[model samples]
Target: MPLADAGLTAWSWNPLTDIQVMWSYPFMVNAFRAGAVIAVLSAAVGWFVVLRRQTFAAHTLAVVGFPGASGAVLVGVASGYGYFAFCLAAAVVIAMLPGAGQGHGEESALIGTVQAFLLACGFLFVALYKGFLGGVDALLFGSFLGIGDGQVVLLAVVAVVVLAVLAAVGRPLLFASVDPSVAAARALPVRALSVVFLVLLGAATAEASQITGSLLVFALLVMPPATAQLLSPRAAVSLPLGMLIGLAVTWLGLTAAYYSPYPVGFFVTTFAFAAYVLARAARTAATAFGARGPRPGTGATGGTPHAVEEAAA
Candidate 1:
């Protein structure tokens, strides 16, 4: 059945029919596949990103790629690869910056400076090759309908490499993130780890930018991990759970966008935002109503033997 016959139209009331329709199309299948890969990678890296307080860096990388991708399109180059390369280079430079903390204002200042220059270069490239404007726009905003088999394979490869690196260094990364002073004292190669993680983050951002658009990649990367933190601060439990949530939101967003008039990026972002809000609310409620007791050895309710004996005897 063709996508049209399967109810890909915006007005389709039967979700089952819409899903059937979308599944029948190879492009839609590939889009969802790509989304799943991006989601997993984003969530995993994002967990560390939140722990390290690098949300600004993630957001900056997403936006900075806009000009690189646009410039590639204008110059008749492979825009995806160009954007990835540019982002990786930028990540290296940012990681190398001297002792500058990842403060929001400072990060934003650096990112804004880089973004302004890239945007200008992007515009210049577009002007030199006016015919490719539509292609550039599509890359910037995203077009799930345009994703091909080649892009899917590229995303898969990137995802696999990133996950492998993340797993290999997972323990040290956590240690450094939670308590850098102790990690450094142990001579754990903290700086090298930070550099490596930033590179991997750059790769993840590049992959996510393809599906979520450069502007909204942060939605999937930052939001899901932040949400997971709210629900459970323990890295052991929250890490895997966060990835699951990210994957679920991506799949849901893609499905919803396939049948609705809205763009896929919009749906994906909306789902991420909603998840964050819901998780925060649950956390707040739990904190308000959950367990509470006096300190041990300081009160009648303390867990001392006398208290236990008095209560029981």
Candidate 2:
């Protein structure tokens, strides 16, 4: 698989031909499949992560996967097991910290402490590895060259299970996110929901790291959802819109990386950041235009002012 040879010297004018050439390799096929699965899972869980204001916790979980992968390599096992095990364990540990009911300042402090510790452990594991570790660049940034059938299947199965669990708890979770005090007054299990969501977020973060690497997983996890929220406030629209944005960026990144000599993470992050900037500009323009429009009950028809309209009402 001359994926290293830059099989595609130049993109043709024909879109179909370009796509056909790109998809000819089995590795490319697996890369696309794995990227799609990770994007969907990350975007879905990321919406909640943003809504619950748990981006700090999400960042901690993402970093936790690095040490997990490194430790797995040290112990002579598949990295996927280490990714899930360490991330889930870290999530549970974060949830069980003593600052549950206290302010976010304390919880965030504890989460940051854990993140720092795990990162140091990752460096230690890397130092302990006696082998050449040729794939260290891929571990930190990203590479789409080595995705396989088994990895694709594993990603798909994990995405299905995580999304299903999210769907099961969607409403109560939303209620709790919006107003935890009110939800608790109604007998909802706020704490339990928080723990479950963190675990799921951990799982999603770990899986996403397989393609984007632990450092750049936020390209999928945060950017798309943040851009979607800027476009629309409604969850029904923004949630799936975020997924679509993530999937688009992933496919675009894979395609770009295949033709260029750069890492996939760079392309993915660049594309997502571009989309967010565009969305922000559009929102700003709309706000400015709306402010300049005619006020309520005072249009070109010589309508009464808002005060007059209210008086008549």
TM-scores of the candidates are 0.85, 0.87
Give the per-residue lDDT of model 1 (tens digit) for 1-313.
Answer: 1343556455477878867876888988998898888899999999999999998788778776777777777667766776688778878887898553365555667657767777777667766776766655556656577678887898899889889999999999999988999999999999999999999988988887887878788778899888877765456667787788899988988887776666778888898899888766655544443325333223333232233333333
* lDDT of model number 2: 0.80
In order, what lDDT does every prediction score? 0.76, 0.80
Off by over 4 Å in 1: 1-14, 104-110, 135-137, 291-313
TM-score of 1: 0.85
**Given candidate 2, what's the lDDT at residue 264?**
93
lDDT of 2 by residue, 1-313 (tens): 1454655446676889878988888889999999999999999999998888777677778788888988887888767778889888888987887544223664667656766888889778877887636666666677787678988898899999999999999999999999999999999999999989989998998888887888888889988998887766668877898999999999999988887778898999999999888777665655455445543223321121222223322
Question: Highest lDDT among the candidates is held by which one?
Answer: 2
lDDT for 48 in candidate 2 is 91
Residue 299's C-alpha lDDT in candidate 1?
Answer: 36
Evaluated against the true structure, the overall lDDT of model 1 is 0.76
